[model samples]
Target: MTQRSITVLPGDGIGPSIVAAAIKILDAAGCQFQYDYADAGLSALEKYGELLPQTTLDLIAKNKVALKGPLTTPIGGGFTSINVTLRKHFNLYANLRPVVSFAGTQSRFENIDIITIRENTEGMYSGAGQTRALDNSSAEAMSIITHEGAERISEFAYQLAVKEGRKKVTIVHKANILKSTSGLFLEVAREVALRYPQIETNEMIVDAVCMNLVMYPERFDIIVTTNLFGDIISDLCAGLIGGLGMAPGANIGKEVAIFEAVHGSAPDIAGQNIANPCSVILAAIQLLEHLNMQDQAELIRAAIKKTLAQGKTITQDLSGSASTTEFTDAIIANL
Candidate 1:
């Protein structure tokens, strides 16, 4: 068997601690891989003077897969976003985030198995915006959207639904108000819907979609939308299950994929060792599944599910009594 190569970018703060735990779990599971350490975010700027170095991009291009820890986008903005850059650079247009309710975790709803398929590239995130301040009282940011971007993402969503055995896909947009931009998004989605006859398709305005999500989350199986809407709704979906701490995400393209924790870097709790590693650990499971190590992925997921169902050693947010490493060890023991 050829060893799978992966670029590991453990950015500043709790990213290192959490990723360390995930690596330990992978090692114990005997996952064969070579990890190349790379730089991004604040740590990268401090060391290499660039948040996302060309070398880092080069490494990911070479490896074609990366397992990244949470990266803190700088406040004042040197780069737009390291995450966004990686996605666009590789044309990673599909951002998949699965929000499932764990057995033991505290959740508002039960049996919530929703997957948010976000259009990762293009839309307003493509740096297609103009900012102008007319005497500070009024400022405008013009967002642009294209049919090509919308159609590809919608098609990707439908194909994913078919592949994953999902029944329906809901296209969420804001076409009612943002007529031109979001209208085009909906038009493209409807165009794509024609091709996927077997899968049921629906469209919901972004606002209504949020309300429906809270009122009846089970109605949604796969939610696909533009970049900005997807960013908001994905987190909202996370809340229905628990919170961002428990969410895991993947940025995928034809050639490469990057698995990462969906939450941001918690600088305050950086070295406290109290941060949750489940998100990153689960992301590693996603990496395994992406590599076609289905058996290994199932083993890890089963161990996690079993551990959670037992309700013994969970993190603070999950309302249990265990440190980060302790929780990780519990999962490893169960495995």
Candidate 2:
């Protein structure tokens, strides 16, 4: 088999350790690939005087796939988000976040499986236009939504639903109040939903979706929404199973795709060896699936599920005392 090269960003705080654990697990699962390492985030800022260096960008462009750890964007600086920068640069317009229940985790629900398809490159979250009053009293930011952006993202969501054999897709929007932007999204999504008659389609307001997600999460199989709502709803779905530590996200475009742990870098626990590595490990599974290596992805996922079910070597966040390395070793042993 030919080897594929993947760009690996070890990010900041606990990112390095967790990403290393993921790499170890991928190797154990018998994935054959060459990894090209690069730096980004605070580490890159310190080393190269920039949050995202040109070398890192070039490597990502060359490799076409990246497994990134959580990056910390310095607050109150003239700095932009590294993740946003990468996504915009690559035109990664679709964000896929799936969460499922794992036994032995401190979760309130069971058998929960939901995929949140987010419009990654547009809407209010895009940071498009911003203006502040000279007297520091009023501020405004534009929420831009294009017909092309809405249509493509809607198509992507329905296509994914069909591919995954998902039963229903709930289109979440705030069309009642924000009738211009969100209304456009709802209009486009409805038009796209007509193309897929086999799959069921439901429309819900953004706020109502939140209430129903907490009340009747099982009613939702797939959720497609604008960028800002998707971001918040995905995190809420994460809470349904466990936490952000159990969530993995994929930013995908036509050419390049990047998988990452959806959680933030825990700077307080940087080298403590107690941070959970499941986020990055799950992200590696996404990476494998993206590469069309389904067998390896399933093998690793089964190992993780078995280990988590056994509940012997889970990390602190999972209400266990085992260190990150111990938990990772347990998963590898299961593999």
Best by TM-score: 2
lDDT of candidate 1 over 236-314, digit per residue (tens) = 9889877877899999999999999888898888888888898898899999989899887888888888988999988
Relative to the true structure, candidate 1 reaches a TM of 0.96
Every candidate's lDDT = 0.87, 0.92
TM-scores of the models, in the order given: 0.96, 0.97
Least accurate 10 contiguous residues by lDDT in model 2? 127-136
For residue 196, give model 1's deviation from the true position in Å. Answer: 1.3
As a whole number from 0 to 100, the lDDT of residue 150 in candidate 2 is 96
Q: After superposition, how far is residue 76 of candidate 2 from its true place, in Å?
A: 1.6
